[model samples]
Structure formats: structure tokens, C-alpha cells
Target: MASAAFEDIAETFEFLDDWEDRYRHVIELGKAMPPLDPAFKVPATKVDGCASQVWLRPVVSGQGPAAVFDFQGDSDAMIVRGLIAILHALYAGLTLAQVGQVDAGFELGRLGLNEHLSAQRSNGVRAMVERIRSVAAV
Candidate 1:
């Protein structure tokens, strides 16, 4: 099951004026996620170009607006783990169109982390998006 809706995440970030608080919230989200099986963390699902080791497993169901997509992801870095959790909260169980509709840049910008994120972290997240796009396309 998904955590709080992405809307709730947005609201929480909006209410948290302090960046540290928002970052803490995201970290907590990551901590709450159940660990993935070691068997699923193979090189085949590894995300390329990430500064830290990361893996994503995706499951797609139904079709069109009725589609539901869920992903399990993990990262060796704590913050990256949190970022992966954010993606899952926002996208898990959503339709293919809904997944395509996620404006991650805008969302992060709204959360005020767009300018604050390091280039490497940003690139890692961009890779995450590309991976999600590819899986959903299939």
C-alpha cells in the first residue's frame, strides 16, 4: 500500500517552512519503507549514473486511466533512499497516464528543494524518472 498521497506530501512540505524539516520528513518516509529482498537488487534493475547504488522494481497493471503502477526502490545513500520513497509515494498504484502526468521538477520546485539539491542528487533523480518512464512505456 502507498503512504500518504502525494497531495499530502505536498501539503506537508508547504506547511514546513524550514527546509531541514521537510528533509527530515522525507527521511522519515524512507525509514518507514520496508526493505526490499536482496534477490531483487540485481544489476539488471540497477539505475545507471546514480552517485549511490540504487535499484527499482516496477509492476504495472490494467491499462489506460485504469492502470495501476507500483515500484519498489532502494538506495545506499540515505537521502537518495528518501528521494526514492518520495517517487513511490507519488507514483505507486497510479495509472500510466497519471504516472506520465507527474511534474517532478515542478513538484520539487514547489517543495523548495529544486534549487537546494546538489547536481549529483538531481541527476540521480532524473535517472529515476527516466527509468520510470521506460518501465511504464513497456
Candidate 2:
């Protein structure tokens, strides 16, 4: 399930008539997100398969599957950073168990991202999702 924060973004997307406006909105969302600390942008946090340099620092609250999941993310490219912000909205604050249940493709499709995102960007998103799932699984 998508988080409320993600739902809000989807709602906004519904009102944006053109892809350009939607892109602007996405970029604005990225701009609004707090920057991840430079210290955490290390090899361990780096996500592969992304054209841009990207890092995700997972923050779990508590132990086991019941733990809440969150992350601080960053990207060298603006659009990629915006994508990370979108992913954060989709997954942040969810329980580790709940994270596994989210249908990311379906949720992202609701925003019409599937049609607009480049092939590489879509793959990068998948890679990031895989990274998130892997961390939660551990």
C-alpha cells in the first residue's frame, strides 16, 4: 500500500495536465526533501544500476519485522533525487513487514510515471526498491 504522503503526490499528479508540470512538481518535491548527510554517502549505502550516483541510508526503528522503516537518500542528478523523494514518500514510515507488501509498480503507475520515465530511470527505481527490500529482509 502507498503511504499517505505518496497518495498526496498522486493526487497532485492527477491535477497536473502535462508531463512538464508533473516533472516540475517532482523536482520541487526533491528540493523539499532534506539532504542526506555526506558521511553516509559511502560504498555500503550506494545503490547500483543507477546512472547517477545515489545513496540510501536506512533507518529502522526497533527490531524484527515489526520495525518501522525509513531512509535518507541522495543523488547527484536532480531528477534522480526527485525519484528518491518519490520512493521515500512511498515507503517511509511503513513497517518492515509492510514494506514487502507494497506494490511499487502499481502505485507508481497511478502517477503515470511508467509512461514518462526513461528505461534507465525505471531500472534504477527497481534497483532502489530491491535495495530497500533487502535491507528490510535482513
Candidate 3:
């Protein structure tokens, strides 16, 4: 399920008629995110299958399934960084258990991202989603 923040993004996407404008909005969302610390950009946090270098560091609060799930992500590519922000909006603040239940594709599809992204970018997004899910699963 999408979070309120993500719903907001979807609403914005709906308001913006042009794919170019949506693309710019995504980049702007990426720019708005705080940069992840360089130290966290290590191999351990790096997401595989991404065309661009990307890292996601999980920050769990509390314990067990009830723990809140949050992460800090960064990317060398601006659009990838924005993608990370979108993922953050999708999964962050959710319970660690809840994170696993999110249908990332369907939620993202609501914003029509699948049609706009290149195949590589689509794969990259899947990789990122898997990374987030894996972290929450543990």
C-alpha cells in the first residue's frame, strides 16, 4: 500500500499532464531529499542490478516486526536519486512487517512510471525495491 507521502506524489503526477513535467518533478523530489552519508555508500549498502551506483541504508526503530522501517539512499544519477525518494515515500515510516506487503509495481504504476522508464531504469527500480524488502525481512 502507498503511504500518504506517496499518494501526494501520485496526485502531483496526475496534475502534471506532460511526461516531461513529471520527469522534472521526480528530479526535484530527488533534489529535496537529504544526501546519504558517503560512509553508508559502501559495498554492504550498494544495490545490485542498478545501471547507476546506488546505496540504501536501512534505519529500523524498535524491534521485531513492529519496528519502523526507514532508509537513506543515494545515487550518482539524478533520476535514480528521485526514484529512491519515491521508494522512500512508498516504504519509509511503514512497519518493518508492513514493508514486505507493499506491492511496489502496482503502486508505482498508479503514477504511470512503468510506461515512462527505460527498461534499465525499471530493472533498477525493482532492484531497489528488493533491497528494501530484504532489509525489512531481516
The positional error of residue 123 in candidate 2, measured at the CA in angstroms, is 0.9
The order of the candidates by TM-score, greatest first, is: 3, 2, 1
TM-score of each: 0.90, 0.98, 0.99
CA displacement after TM-score superposition, residue 64 of candidate 3 (Å): 0.7
Per residue, candidate 2 scores C-alpha lDDT tens digits across 49-69 of 998899999999999999999
Find the number of clashing residue pairs for candidate 3: 0
TM-score of 1: 0.90
Q: Please tell me which predicted candidate would have the highest TM-score against the true structure.
A: 3
- Estimate candidate 3's alpha-carbon lDDT, on a 0 to 1 scale: 0.96
| Candidate 3 ranges beyond 4 A from true positions | none
Candidate 3, poorest ten consecutive residues by summed lDDT: 36-45
108-130: candidate 3 lDDT, tens digit per residue: 99999999999999999999999
Best by lDDT: 3
The Cα RMSD of model 3 versus the native structure comes to 0.5
Clashes of 1: 0
